[model samples]
Every structure is written in structure tokens, then in C-alpha cells.
Target: MWSAHHRRTAILGWLVFVVLATVVGGATGTVTASDDEMGTGDSARATKILDDAGIDEPASELVMVGAKSPDGWRDAAADLSRALDRTGRVTALKEPLPSKDGKEALLRFQIKGKSDDAADQVQPVLDAVDRAKDAGAEHGVTVHQFGDASSEKHLNDLLADDLKKAEFTAVPLALGILLVAFGAVVAALLPVGLALTACVAAFGLLSLASHQLHLFETTFSVMFLMGLAVGVDYCLFYLRRERDERAAGHDAETALRIAAATSGRAVLVSGLTVMVAMAGMFLSGLLLFKGFAIATILVVCVAMLGSVTVLPALLAWLGDRIDAGRIPFLNRRSRKGVHASGSVAGSLLKPVLAKPAFFAVAATALLLALAAPALGMKTEQLGLEKQFGSDAPLSVSFREITAEFPGGPEPALVVAKADDIRSAPARDALRELTRRAGKGAELTVHARQNVAEIAVPLPGSGTGAEAKKALAELRADVRDVRAGTGSAHGPALTAYVGGDLAESEDFTDQLGEGIVPVFLFIAAVTFLLMLVSFRSVVVAVTSIALNLLSVGAAYGVMTAVFQHGWGASLIGSEKVGAIENWMPLFVLVVLFGLSMDYHVFVVSRIREARDRGLGNADAIREGITRTAGAVTGAAVIMVAVFAVFGMLSMQDMQQMGVGLGVAVLLDATVVRMVLLPSLMSLLGERNWHTPRYLRWLPQVSHDEPAPAARPASPTWQHV
Candidate 1:
């Protein structure tokens, strides 16, 4: 439909689609998930029971003040409590609690609305904290604020600031790289412009979808990062091919057709493969994963459509003017295509073609070496201490509170329920649970009617290794309480552990259990896609292995940097000591899809040369050399976009951005440039082999003429 023959129709249709998507998305605002909706496993169940009892735990935060003088500390605590309650955004306020030594005190409160609404209502609470800080200073005390509402506000604000910074950083850097590659301002800007446009459209689509779904806050950034990287990459593939064909002396129409016939087909295949990998996230059985997959799939599909339909129309409209604003020396070099033959890729290909076995073994070994650290990679849900930004006020306050107070703000809430807790046996069970909790841990339990909420004070911000151990011991004793109770009710009542620690542990366990199925699904699907695309079993197997190697290396690098704190010093990150619970599944789905864009494009070019009667060695060199310039340019652009994500203050965003950027670098340089050629060079003619049983697979050509060895008949026509 976007063929040059329908130039005006294609151009107008694309413009309408982008505009319509945005308008519809704006009309229906996004709907965010509730706290219970965000949960999974034991933690989720505990939260649900709390909710059913009409309890609203407003993500309570605290303002802590410390002083040497007992009189000053008491005065500061009174002042802080009154100031917070006067804000009118809080539903309930608790009396200030003082430490035994009278050195510190904390005022706690629940926000007026639900947990999700707390972030939006934090302005009043913040203003109150500001007042407390000033009042504490005058009273000869120190004050700091940290809690659930404060965390939401700070993280949301930080992410918004980081995204704005990324735009200003990534776009200009990408344009400059494109200028160096294309040697013309107009030609270079096209890819970046197209990428930005696609992101806007993807945002529109996601916004519309959000009404029918429960969108997470992180989904927007994920879409932006993925949409921009893949959009530009697809555009670069098509534009480079069109220009190369034009440079080879073809007219405008002919160049576009050949570009569409080749790069366009690769985009379709690559986009489908990305969707397939994204589909694996649905197996996770977590709403967060499913939501992420839906949003990203929308972005990738929209970007793919633009690359095929609108990109061709834009090129057709530009004609000879695409290269109008050419740079002098660079233009001269580009005009003669110096990069296609005299590049480092060309030099590197020689050794691989000469001794395929040696290079193949060496490159494989290096990738595995990079992947070694992942074997010991630890997993955890980031605690408050781990999730906090270094400069966030709440983080500073949290540290102060932990140092000065016996029990900090964060504590584990263990909720247990029964029909009639006032009965003798039920009462004994509750008493026994409370008694057992106090044995080896600092704990307190409160009972009202049929329910009991046991508050376990977690020392050290309530998320350290010792805190977790205490929680485990408390849980072990709960079984004993269950055995002692509920005969009056005629059934044993069980307590569910839920809190920051429980949520993290449950999600990590979920990821661990579900990841194998997701991985196997992606591997099986990608291998089949490659098999169908290449019609060679060896090629399909090689693609799958290389992708695994690249993803494994990414995981290893992430573990070393984020888990082991290897790069924390250089990057100014607070040492997390564990990976984010969601990162491994997220990276796998995204990396597999993205890495395939380059793999399929280069492999298609190689197959074309082979079909054109070149020997395996010659075809490998020509195909890789011909496509190397564009592939490297696209890869660099992608890496640049991802690197900007590393600049964000959020730890999860940093981990993902750096991991993706590094993975792409590895895949393009080692896997694509070195390992691929070596493997193919070793296989020779076997690289193109197709079994008779698989002859029913459709033939998708890549701008290559029909082979003289085969009969002339139309197998497929879309490409």
C-alpha cells in the first residue's frame, strides 16, 4: 500500500494514523493499578485481607527529629505532629514516639486517600515536613522525612526529570552520528525525526490501552526507550539500502523498490520476532509483566508500520533532495562509499575467512567468559535502602531515623483472621502468636474483633539480611500458634506475611518459577522464525546460540555491576547488592527482539549473495561488508539511546539502560561482525542447505534475483 505508485495516499494515511492515535489516547486518560492489583503471592493475599477489613494503610511516612536535650526533642516532636495533622491531607495522626535515651522522636500519619493517590497528595505533606525541618533547627533538633508517599513523589519526579534530560541528550547525539554516517544534515535528520514521531504515536496507543488495562508508572519510560531505539534502527536499515542502491546508479523509484524489497522485509520479520518474544512475558502470570509487554508490543508494531509505510513515502517525496545539505569532506567520502570496503569490518573479515575454526572458538569462549559472573547472581526485591536515590531527602532522613531510633519507620505487617477471635481458643491462638513473636524478635501484636495485625519491628530499615532472618523465625513460630488456636471457631486460622520484604520475595520467586517457561518459549519461537526465514537448520541453530550468548553476557554484566557493586563507584549508585526482581525477564524479552534486527538484516544480505551464485566465503565477505556500515551506524544509534537511560536516577532504569546498551554493543561487534562470519565461513555451502521436508515454507526474497538453479514461480509477493 505504501509503494511509490501510491505516494500521496501512503503519505497522507501515515500522517492521519499518527495524529489519530495521539488524539484518541489523549481523549482516554491512563488508568493506574491499585496496590493490591500490583501484588502477587502471599503478600498480595495479606493485603487483600487487610483491604477487606476496611483498613486503609496510606503508605505512611514519618518525620523524624533528633536532639541531645530531652526537652528540645519533646518540643520538636509535638511541633512536628501538630504541623502534619494541620496539613488536612492526612486521615489519621499518631502520637509522637520517643526513643529510650530521649535523643530522637518520630511522628507518623496516614494519607487521606488510597495508596495510589498518596503520590499526588504529597505536596501538603512535603510542605509540613519543610516546616518541621525549620522548627526542629530552631528547637536545637534535626528533622528528616521518609515514607511510602514520599517515595512515590520522589521517584515519579526523578523519572520525569530524567526522561526530559534523555531527550535533550539522546536526540542531538544521534543526529550527529547520523550526520557523520550520511554526511548530510537532511538525510541524517530523517531517521531521528522518524524515531521521535513513532514514539509519540506509540505513547498515544499505550495511553488508549491504559484505560482498559492497569498501567504501571514505569511503562511509559520503557516504551519511550524501546520505541526510539527500534524506530531509528528500522529507518536506518531502509534508508541506507535506498541510498546504496541510488549510489549504485539506480533511479529513485528503482532504489526504493529494492530497499523495500530487502530492508523492508527484514523489518517485518524482525518486528514479528520482537512481538513473539514479548508474548513470552504473558507466561509470567504477573500483571506488571503483561502490562509491560502490551505497551512495548504497541510501540514496536507502530514503529514497524512507520518504517514500511510512511518512510518509503517520505523518501519518494524527497527524491534527489535527500542528500541536499551535504557536508564537504564527508560528502566526498560518502559519494564514493569509502565505508563499504575500507572499514575495519573489512579488515577483520580476512582473518575469520582464513581460519574460521580458530576465530569461532575464540569468540565463543570470550562471550562465555563475560557470562560467568551470572552463575552466582543474587536476587532480591530492592528494600527502601536499596531503592533510595542518593540525594533524595527521604533517603537521608531514613538513615538518620535508623541511627537515632530503636525502630525505624518501616515494619512488616503480619495479618491473621478468624470468624470469632473473642472465643477462648481463638484468643489463646492470638496470645500464643504474640508471645512467640516476642521470644526471639522485637514484635508487638494488636487485635480488634476477628483480626490481628502483628507489627514486626525490622532493625536497620527493616530490609537487611538479619531482618529477613527474623521474619523467617517469626513465620516458623506462626505454625505453632496455628496448632494452639481456633477450636472455638472449629478451624485453624493462618497468618499471611506481607510487607516490603514479602512483596519482593514473592515476586522474585514468581520470576524464578516462570522464567524457564518464558525462556524456552522465546528460544523455540525464535529458532523456528530463523529456520523459516533462512531455510537452513544450521543457520537457525547458530542464530539461537549467538542470541543466548549475547543475552547471558548482558545478565552477567548487570550482576557484576548492580549486584556486586562493581560499577557503583564510577556511576555514583548506592550499592544495591542485588538485581531488581523484574530485570532478567524484561532484558531477555527486549534484548532478543532488538538484537534480531541486525542479525536478520545481515543474514538476509548474505543469503542474497549466496543465491546469486557466490561461494560461501565470497558471499560472507560481500554480504557482511555491504551491510556493515549501516548495521554499525544503527547499532551505535541504539547504544547511544540506551546509554542515556543509564543517566537516570532510578536504579532499575539504570540497570536496564546499561545492560541493553552493553548487550547491543557485544552483539553487533563480536556476535555479528566476528562470530557470525566465522561460523558461516566454516559451513561453506552447508549454510544454504534446506531439507526436502521443509520445502513447503514460503520463499521470502531479499532484493535478490531468482536463482538460476530454481524454477520461476511466485512463492510469496508481499516483500
Candidate 2:
């Protein structure tokens, strides 16, 4: 009777989501204004080149140069200068500067605009550079250009190109996974549609939030994609269950209520669990993780709302229509497999039950073995060039420059304050320190009345481990020098190192310290929630243990692939150094949430069967069989969506994609499919038993209380 009411509510909920998605999508175009502001790697490199060339301060005069024999290159440069003049942004460009590489050209220009958009005002100058390329080509010369304005223009274009590719791959892959999982075209489309709606709304909300808080550009796109994948996954569980119930002969309304009461409750708990897990990122004291945590929480909350409200409502409205186009080869004959009766899962579990002590010890041993590598897991910063693309021109050029100049690109800065720099003893000490630092390399010292700044050029090429080691040595030398400089300047001469390596080291250290506590907190919360939901100590403990095993194995795989350089060549990354600093926290939050989702679905069904008066063994067998197909299908879909990230050029995306895909696949198959059922079946009625005092807690039973006696089914009913 109450089932029909819930179905109507579910239909109405979906309608709301659709409306919200449409309104948000229509109001905002795909591109944002900030897209223009986020400059390219080329721009960063160009700025570094100019800075190194000692070009600073506002410029009114500029120059442009082209290849000597290339008439076409000279013409193109002239055209770009005219374009810049047309914009009324710059005063004029001087004739091309002499080309360092013979085939390339350079341009110097003057800024005329008072507007803050003066940087953007140089668009015409960029156009002229492009035009000059043709001239260089005609003369068998390549037109390579470098300048502040040209660099910015190049960066913007590159980012736009990469973004286009990412969108092209992520969307189609996500939709295709859904289609295969649901079988029916329309049914599969629903979750993707809902996920898109949530993501659009999240982007708008995040943009607005950014005005009041700090949010990185990368976070927005990554969170949106990840949130969509998870949201679709959440909806898939509920919708699949509802379909299964209807196929089993329950009316649409009854199926809706049953799904909502069971799967719906699971969705709510799972969503909250995911949110709680993500909140652990707050412990890192990093705005990046904090932003992600907040964004993820919002997306999960919206997804949960859709699962409970829209999913049920859609089921009621569609009725049997949800299963209209079943794929001939793929549709299950009977949503039952090995665990259908006291058959496969039950029989397999029976043996484990017969020797619980052995199986328990064996499983524990396996988990510990996989967990061993994690103890030695090292944390380090991924090189930006390596993250983007090892063979990219910027990366290649930077390497060349570093090799030629050594630590010229990356210098360790040592800043110290002293009571007085005029003292003969202090001057001597400083000179000696600088001489020692420069012994094996080039070191430059600058001193003021009360301060000294030392620039130490490290040995070997820059942008890799050797450069980092040199910086470390320089810091140690500075420390030794400070210690030896006695009481005259001792207290006031405190020194601190500040540079690329210092900042990166600080970030990595913070990330490592925060991961353990955050993981423990997430585990503790998951344990309490499971205990409260199922009222069984063993079940709660077993659930956490299984989740950890899956996570551990996933990390081990990452260690092998990313850290050990296994298959790295296939992926395009040259050096496999260390995992991303924050990947562990991100992986933990995501894995815990996903693992809990499956756990709740499987256990909830078992509890439903048990409530119908079936013994623990029979209920588990039935529960697992009924739910396994749907769980497996859903996991496959998720795995597919996550795997798409592996196609991206970005290293961070690859790590995230591989880590999540492996974890989900393992949890769904090995841990959930085999181990969970085996463990539960062995426990029997004890699996659902609660402690004496805890019996007072409210319990929602899925089955109606049975009459004292009933006729047994001919095939398998037992007295």
C-alpha cells in the first residue's frame, strides 16, 4: 500500500533534476572567462627566458626579427607588427631582433595601453608572428618566436586544445559504459543524464564558491568528471534492483518501495559514508584537497538525492518500460548464478565454514603480504614537465637549457640576517662559506648592510634528482656556516632556505603525515556506521578488512607500474619517480566510499532474506545470487569509465584512473564476490545476531512477520 506513494515521489524527483540540469546548462556556455587568464607552459617558459635575460620593467620600445635570407619570414613579422598596431594596444615594434638559431625570428614591442588588459592587448603581435611563419617556410627556415605576449598566446591555445581532447574522450566512454550495463538504451541513459545534470550544477556552484574561496582550475574539471562517474554508479545500483524486483513479479509500485527501503537506504548510507571519507582530506591543511572534499561532498549529496528521489520516481513512471529493449545475448536468463541457492556460493562457503580458522588465517596472510609494499611507499613531487608530456617542446627545451647552464634555471636561495655585515670576522666567514659552496660548482653571493643572499648552482642537469640533491647539499653547507659564525652575529644570523625544492618538500612532508590519521579516521567512521546499520561486530570488522585489502592491492599495483617504471614507456612517462603527494588520500576516500556501496547492497539483501525466516546460510546464498549480477554489471561500467582517464596525457589523471579502476575491479570480484559470501555463509545465523543491549535499537525488517506454520514449497522448502 505504501509502495505506490513512494513511486510517485521518485518520478517527481527525477523531473526536478532534469529541470535543474536544463536551466544550468542553458545559462552557461562551455567556456568560462577565466580560461583566457590561465596561461600556457610556453608562456611560463617564455617569462623565465626573459627574466633570465634580465629584461624587467615596463617597455615602450620593441623589436622584431626574421631569418636573413627568408623574405617570407620578414614579411610575416611586418604583418604581425601591423596587426598589433591596429589593436591600438602597443605603440610599435622595432625591427626583428637577431635570431639565435638562424631559422627563427624575434620581436621587441612597446606597450601603449593603460588598461590592465595590456597583456591581452598584444593579440595582433601574435597574429603577425603566425603570418611570419609562412615566409620562413618559403625560405626553408622555421619561424620560432619568443616573447611575453607570444608565450601567453601559445599557452592559452594549448590548454584549449587539451581540454577539447579530454571532453571528447571522457563523455563518450562514460555513456558507452552505461549502455552496456543497463542493456536497455533508455534505462542506461538515465543515470548518465542525471550525472551530467549534477556536474553542471556543481560547476556553477563551484564557480560561485570560488569568488569567496580559493579553487584551482584543475580541481573543477577533475571533480566534475569524478563526481559524474560516482553519481551514475550510485543510481545504477538502485535502478537495477528495482528492475530485478519487477521482473520477479512484484508490481512496479511494490518494486519501487522495496528497492527504496533496501537499496535506497543503502544509497543514503553509502553516500554519507563517501562524504565522511572525503572529509578526511581536510586534515592535510591544503586548499586543494579542501576544495576537492567540499566539491565531492556536494556531488555525492546530489547523487544520493537523485537515487532516492529521481530513481524511484522514474521507476514508477516507466513501470515495465525500463526493461523494454533487452539485449538478446546479454540479458540474464534468471538473475541467478553460482549463489542462486545452496549451490555454488553456499557450497563453497560451507567448506570454509568447516574450517573457519584456516580460511581466516589464510586471508589475513594474503592481505598482509600485499600491504608490505605500502610501508616503504615514498612521497615526492611529480615534475611538471613529466606530468604534462615528456617529449613536449617545453620539456625538451628546458632540459637542454638545464644541461647547458646547470643550476642556472633552478637556484637554491639562502637568505640570512646578521647584526652587522661590516665586521671583518663576519665578512671573512661569509666569504669562506661562499668559497666552499662554489668549490665544486658555481655559487654567487650578494650581501647588503644586514642581509646576504646566496645563489648556489647545483651540479648535473636540472629538472631531475641530481639537481634536487645538489640543492640539499647547498642547504646543509649554509647551515654549517651559520653554526660556525659565533655569538657576535649568531642570534641575528638565522638562515632559512626558500626555493622550488623547499616548497615541494614541505608539501610532500605534510601530505605524508596527514594520510595515516585521515585513513584511520575514515576507517573508524566506516566501522561505526556499518556496526550501527547491520548490528553485527563481525560483519563490520570483516567489511573494513576487505576494503583495506582491495586498497592495499591497488597501491601495490601502482607502486609497480608508476614507481618501478613497469610499462611506463607504453604510457609515455620517462622516469617513474614517486606517486603524487595527495594520491593516497584521494584513493582512500574514493575506495572507501565505493567499497561501502557494494557492501551495503550485498548485506542489505541478505538481511532482507533473513527477515523472511530463512536460516543465515540459505539467506546469504539467495541474497548473493539475487544481487551478484547487478553488482558485477555496475562494477564493470564504473571500471570502464575510470579507465578512460588512462588515455589522457596528464600524469595525475593516469594515476587516478589506474588506481581507481584496479581497486573497483578487485573489490567487486575477489573481495565481494568470493571472500565476503564465504565468510558470511560460514557464520550462519550468527551473522545477523546483535548483542543483548543493542537489541533495543530500531530494526527495519524487509519481510513481513511469518505465520507460525506454512506449507513448504515442493522443490526446496525445509521444515
Highest lDDT model number: 1
lDDT of 1 by residue, 1-719 (tens): 24454667887887788899899988888888776778898889888887887776667877777887774678767766777778888866777777677677777778888877898998988987787778667657788788888877888887788888888898898998888888898899898888888889888888888877788888888888888889889999999999888878876666787888889999999999998889899898888988899988998998898899888978877888898899998787665554554366788899988999999999999999989989988878775555666556667777777776644576767778877656666666767777776733333333563667777776666777877887777767776677666455465676777778777777888999989999999999999999999888888888888899999999998889888888766766756778888998999989989989999999999988887888888888888998988888889999998888876778888889888999999999999988999998888778788899988988767544322222232311211
What 10-residue stretch in candidate 1 is worst by lDDT?
A: 710-719
lDDT of 2 by residue, 1-719 (tens): 12233555555555675566546645653333221122222222323332343433233323334354644356666666676667666665667644345433455566665322445766665556456556556765454433334434444455455556666776677677656665566777788877777776666556555554456546765666566677787788788777777767775555666677778888888888888988887776666677777778777877777777666656655666776776654335333331242255455555555665577666656656755666667666665555656576545544544443345344555555566755665676667667766754333333443555555666654435776776677668777887877785443354555444555665676677778888888888998888888888788888888888888977876676677776767755544567877787788878998788788888888888887788776687677777776677678767876676655666777777788888898888667656776677667667877889777766655552332332243311210
After superposing candidate 2, which stretches have Cα over 4 Å from the reference?
1-167, 324-376, 414-456, 473-496, 569-575, 682-686, 692-719
Please, what is the TM-score per model?
A: 0.93, 0.74
Stretches off by above 4 angstroms in model 1 are 69-71, 138-140, 333-342, 406-408, 421-425, 439-451, 479-494, 703-719
The root-mean-square deviation over C-alpha atoms between each candidate and the true structure, in angstroms, is: 4.0, 8.4
Best by TM-score: 1
Q: Could you tell me the C-alpha RMSD of candidate 1 in Å?
A: 4.0
Instruction: Estimate the TM-score for candidate 1.
Output: 0.93
